[model samples]
Target: MLLKNERISEIVDGKRVIVKKPELLAPAGNLEKLKIAVHYGADAVFIGGQEYSLRANADNFTIEEIREGVEFANQYGAKVYVTANIYAHNENIPGLDDYLRALEDAGVHGIIVADPLIIETARRVAPKLEVHLSTQQSLANWKAVQFWKEEGLERVVLAREVSAEEIRQIKEKVDIEIEAFIHGAMCSAYSGRCVLSNHMTARDSNRGGCCQSCRWDYDLYQLSDDGREIPLFSENDAPFAMSAKDLNLIRAIPAMIELGVDSLKIEGRMKSIHYVATVVSVYRKVIDAYCADPDHFTIREEWVRELDKCANRETASSFFEGFPDYTNHMYGTHSRKTTHEFAGLVLDYDRETGIATIQQRNHFKPGDEVEFFGPEIENFTQVIEKIWDEDGNELDAARHPLQIVKVPVKRPLFPYNMMRKEN
Candidate 1:
């Protein structure tokens, strides 16, 4: 059996060739999520610092936290990249040079940059730090990729609008490393260049304060000849829509691997730790399985099921197959529901006593059946027959968030193993 980090040999044309698997890149909104990403088999994790990040609302990392996260990921052979992808204004320019230097000193692998100002400053101030062009640049053509390559960018995150054929063409023409968004939310505008947030909520979508105005509902109205207002439709009709369905590309893993894309990125920096773990683990398995043997590769139903468990919105393979149609765009009310809910996280496990210590994430009572999963172990379902608090007192339910609890287990679990229950 082929394992991760091992290259596979394939016969292309009439010659045998060696193929290195693409890196699995995930997102981290905080230190805990960063650890969860690496623990679940991410090859690299991208995080946003406190400044110059589009995810301004996220609990971004401090320099010290970045250093700690780097150390944690390094132990698992994973890399850390910091995001400075916001389009900078005049006031955002000051102290950016210092921040770039600090990220380099903290041993970050690279910085995902969008603004010309930040890119130039990183090149000038921190020459050793690798610079990656963010997807915000919207480099959809091969010539744009060539331009960045000549300008000294190590990689380009292609715009989400780029189709599968476009990606293949870009790879054929440009020799620079290619990174593509494999799964996550899709931007309603062209590569997230929307002004709706700025016009409606006074929040700049480019410079980090996006209010997601595109996802909001607005009353549809029409004007009469007398200049009076009129309702466009009855209350039963769906609202005027602009939101796009979330991207799920599990079915396209084999094609992406064959296209020679260097990295497959998951786009959710502001998502929960449960989200990070679930999504990363699912992709990790899919990529490894396909790379193990290309000829016999088949998309597993369990992989799709695992992804569906964490999805908060409707999902579709957008833009990858071809130009998206009406099915790609979401209208009316979106059901932000999933098949499962994260119940707890494993803190410690005892083999002799068949007991496991867990930190509660959601409410669970005795007799509730929960499923435990991790990167190294097969998933198993167990019924909660008894629960004990940290003080060894019996508890009726694991209700309090982050509360420590003990439960009996049939299989051994390690730290970072997550448990979820059917919703």
Candidate 2:
């Protein structure tokens, strides 16, 4: 599923000019991750609120947090989008109306919504906030995009099934902005409009309490005419037939930009802050590199290596070019591999002492090597030569989670920076 970026050019005043890079849109499950995503170079970040979004399991933002997040992102010239994309019943509208008004008052830049009623409600209750058609709408063609555009949506987050050619065609006919999922998880169903979780667990997937029923293992059984039950296989013997490979379109930046895609989205709202920082940072570099010098654009191996650290599933460019094959599905039990682990988070560093106060996440010994990375800083490597616990006691290793330790280092480290070790 690897896609190489092809050189795309157009004549402007009898001269060839390269296409511009699209806005990099990252996902944030909470306020902390939202700030991290923006600081890591995302031009915009999409987040789910406490209700009416698909990711109910995520640590979604509260009203106060939403206000703060919007203010924080605005300081950096970045935008915050609140997700109210859940399919709602009659019981949900009143609350949704209040929520949309609250968001508009909180200064949110846009609202990602799918239901027609929700969109119409946003227009009525919060007309100032831009409306983005969520992927849940399953918009796959120009007509659908036009339909949503006519419904007053400013942007359309297309379904994951769209191809480059389809995207180009849609842009050619549509006036609204186009967004595509360039990275992260792919739903077994179309844009996650599923009854599996609802029917299996009574936790409605459309209303946001998806139990990920598709990712669960199931055993098939048959009932014979003789009233005897025949087990096809045990749960352990069942395959992950519904699990699709995680999408990684790191190599498609040039082509995506050339297609006039208004936004490039990464889809992980329930993922870790480390995952947010790593994925956003990698894509940021790729996009910046291509935008800076399109003719010399080359997908760096370092970017791939960085992305692999946080990727849970094997990577693929699902449906970007055409229908994907068996390679796009992770059918086996052991299908994912993480190449790095979050070792610790740097809290603060003393310049004169050259000691970094770190909060350990995963265990790392005094002799272990780790890499530290943060906003506006090149990833610097440091060997843990000497370590001491906050109790002023020397330690052979930082053993427990959340253990505070001080390590002497030559390079200056900033607070909120992350440190990782090879897995």
Cα lDDT tens digits for candidate 2, 141-241: 98988888787778999988889999988877877888899999888789656889889998888888887777766556789999998887765565537
**In candidate 1, residue 240 scores what lDDT?**
74
Against the correct fold, how does model 1 do in TM-score? Answer: 0.94
Where does candidate 2 stray beyond 4 Å? 1-19, 218-240, 334-337
Colliding residue pairs in candidate 2? none
Task: State the local distance difference test value for candidate 2.
Answer: 0.85
Count backbone overlaps in model 2: 0
RMSD of each: 3.6, 4.1
Lowest summed lDDT across 10 adjacent residues in model 2 is found at: 1-10
TM-score of candidate 2 versus the correct structure, residues matched by position: 0.90
